[model samples]
Target: MNDNSSRPLRLGTRRSKLAMAQSGQVAQAVQQLTGRPVELVEITTYGDVSRESLAQIGGTGVFVSALRDALLAGEIDFAVHSLKDLPTKQPEDLALAAIPPREDPRDVLVARDGLTFETLPEGSRIGTGSPRRMAQLNAWARELGKEIETVPIRGNIDTRIGFVTKGELDAVVLAAAGLSRIGRSAEVSQFLEPDAVLPAPGQGALAIECAMTNAPLAATLAELDDPYTRVAVTAERSLLAALEAGCSAPVGALADLSPSPDEQIVTEMRLRGVVGTTDGKTLVQLSITGPVPSSSEEAVAMGHELAAAMLDKGAAGLMGERAL
Candidate 1:
């Protein structure tokens, strides 16, 4: 997987501050792993240019299409993406070359007054546009018999958090990974537990993609891959696909590798999945744990099995309400 040439690897990235920061980290890591120089190629995408909200623009392929296009067109040798932004279906011509070690996979609350999900006052308003978060938050609030409002919001982390400073909203929910990526983790008031709010599948992960034709490049990129992280996210994304859920749908899944404590060797991998309506009226959740995965296919199969279990418990009807 050695690059004999001196040319730098062109890493395509969206031109947002967050995307640039993410790409910069990836570029350094890939360069160190492959012994290849890496360059960041900024690309403007429909999602970045559109004034419309994420729901209006459609969700799955928004931020990623331009990068994929650049890769397919040979404009960039490789690209990086927030794995959650990627669709479940893989393209025949493009290969997901690597998924590096993930960051914190849990969501966080950036609330005023250092408040948390449990400590937030009754009727407190929370801001988030993600159906996955909204649904789970609503369901939890209902279970607690606390009447909190979930406001729809769209923008970068700074803009979303601004609502609290401007007194436009009480609080906002954001991924812990995003805040951490930009060195803003200090701003997080509280990290929500996964049991309270299951994170979007592949929330804290990155997808490195390259054209399928580039075997040498693929091998180089694969050197940067963390098999455990890849397998875990594969299980999560596989659940999403088996459920026929869109990336924007109120579906959340998290997979973890639980190694035996004494030996520090992975013994089992557990996956938990949730499906719910936007209104939080109906929610279906399931979990499955078995032997540690030996291959990508086994990990994906575990996710499908969990999805089927949830579907048997009326996960489909809960998801159906999302369309209505």
Candidate 2:
């Protein structure tokens, strides 16, 4: 560890409970590894201040720009973010220093009175604001010949859960990782498998960002980087980048690392792209698989190829419409 006894490393984070919890974990890790004190600074972001819908507020960058501005201004030494909330592009001065071990990268169904998907009544109301989730749920419901209504719901995890508990909605879909981080995993009525609901890119992972010039601090963060998580998330993000999809785009991807007998890890990834009308009446989804990419560039290329295939099949037209 570099001798920085004079100044503690300042860690910037959003004020949300989950964000604080994740930042606390990272601060603790850095403190242990570097033998330095870490200071937590709560920063308010546009996403927190604006009442506008996420898509209306300009996609996912609202949550990240403030924290990134602080980093660039040297107001904080590092920052933590929910990887899924990050945009596909990175700023010139900032570097994604680390991707720690990922949590469960699956969406969960939370329903009132412990009801599972199979048991929910016909015409039951589900709540979620994600176009990706809405599309998948609609497609699956169609396959089952089940008539269910998806209601647009948005807020923090607690607020979203309240919709179900308060009898406003029969169920809601949320990231299993978010629930688990907040110690509310028990609220999950069912863990939707990847085969049924592919997760958004970089879900369940935490991103550490720091200024590119901060070599010493960046090196310290490197200790926390999990290679498996990095590779998997890299591929997923690459796919997102290739598609030119923002965080709100109806794109999902999951990557798995299968180790070969020769002790080499083979990267395998599946990408799912969806396009849907605003009313959720029609949707087109495409899935593609390829060998794990050797680099972020390669992974991005694979994602681009898959996206091109989907577009050729008229995905662009479907996405052009509003998705509620």
Candidate 3:
């Protein structure tokens, strides 16, 4: 071990409640793994301070760059990030050290009067900052012959849910994993399955990143990496990269594993991708199932192949600046 092994590992994270909660969890794990104390270094990010909606201010990346800057400056040893917030392109100087096991990737509905999405009355107002959710919700509403208005919203989970409680909105769409991490999943009235609404690529997963030059620390963090989750999200993010879409784009993707009959082994992997207009009038969704990827190369290829198929079906037209 290097002399620094005895030093407390500083984990850079945003100061948001959700960010702190998740970072605390990772810090505990690192302390256990390295037999050293870990410290939380709270950093304010542009996304956290900006009242502007995500799409207007530049999507999820805004929440990440500040921490990345801290890492590159050697002010923090590593960082924890919601995987969905990471840009498709990785910085050359950093390493994605690990991807912990995922949480539930479904989107959840929290409605007033304990209403599920389907039970909500027509013309009910739903608040969400996600274009992907708006597109799918509109499409789903049309299918049910119901009309609901999607209002653009921005805030942390508490503020978002407050909208419903205050009668400002009928409901809100949020990531089930986020609520679960914050111990608020019980408030969810409905879990929107991938069948109706695919989640953003890499949703429900956490990424631990460190300076690539720090091989010893990177190797230590790699111990927490779950192979299945890594491959699954690799395929998902690769698809996003292939589509040339940013995190704010109206694009959703998920890569799921099919377990064997014994439920002890994964036998196949299924990749799904969707691109749609925010209005929900047009959508292009596609899926592909194949043997579980044995290597990272295979996973990347699978995503590229699936992305190609979606593009052939006119997925690009649905994306505004998301096109190649």
Candidate 4:
């Protein structure tokens, strides 16, 4: 291993407020772990500059390619990424060094006059950049016998919330983890339950990546890895890969420990997945419970099992993509 003992480690991250905040937290943890100085290296990504929606720009890796380039170029020693934004496919040259414990993976609403989704006036406009959120929200509205317009939007938290503040939209939906990390959770009007709307795969998690060749650094970073978090997200992302869906696709997945029959110790896990059209006309949601995976292989198998069941129920047809 190359000697990195005397030099500061460079942590590449995007230039967004949320990105910087999360990266800073990780940097602090890394410094304490390795007793070495850490530096933040901000890189601009195509997703940050493009006015086009994520789906329009090929959402899977738009925000991540530049950072990966920096890692390969040795401009940064490592990078921190919002796991949800990462592509399901891991490159051969890089190593996912660690995944720390996750935050709350639910979606939250910020509405005008402190209004909840159910209480929002009829025909209210709800803004969000995620097709997953739109599909579920519209479906819920239909169940409530109310009308809501899910407007397509793309921007940082401020820009998205501005629409509501400026009266251009009635509310905007965002990840609960994001608002909490930025000390703005107090502004949330409602926390969207996962029962009604599962979050995007790996939604509340962070991925720390390093060059696969950097064995020493990778080992050091691995100290931060949380096995439970890794296994859960692995199952979720595996389902995403099995579905052959990009991050922009209207797919949501979540996995958690399931209680035993006695409702005491947890020895099993439950994985739930959803696929729907952007318009919310149809949805295929299914779940599977099995032993808590002790290895990545087991978790992946569980996801494949669930994906197969969903496919049998026309999940592929809903994604408008290739048949699996």
TM-scores of the candidates in the order shown? 0.95, 0.92, 0.98, 0.97
Give one clash count per candidate, in the order shown.
Answer: 0, 2, 0, 0
Better of 2 and 3 by TM-score: 3
**Which digits, one per residue and each the tens of the lDDT, describe model 2 over residues 1-324?**
234676898999999988988899999999998888999999999998887766676566889999999998889999999999998778888989999999999999999989987788899999987877877787777777788898877788999999998999999999999898889998899999877777888999999999999988898898899877876787777666655667776667777666566856654656565555544567666777777666777767766777778677777666532222
Q: Report the alpha-carbon TM-score of model 1 versus the true structure.
A: 0.95
Tens digit of lDDT per residue, candidate 1, span 195-290? 989999999999999999999889888987999999999999999998887788889999988979886788998899999887788889889999
Query: How many pairs of residues collide in model 1?
Result: 0
Off by over 4 Å in 4: 259-265, 320-324
lDDT of 4 at 290: 89
Overall lDDT per candidate, in order of appearance: 0.89, 0.81, 0.93, 0.92
Q: RMSD of model 4, in Å?
A: 1.7
Candidate 4's C-alpha lDDT?
0.92
Point out where model 1 deviates above 4 Å. Answer: 1-4, 320-324
Clashing pairs in 2: 267-292, 278-322
Return the clash pairs for model 1, or none. none
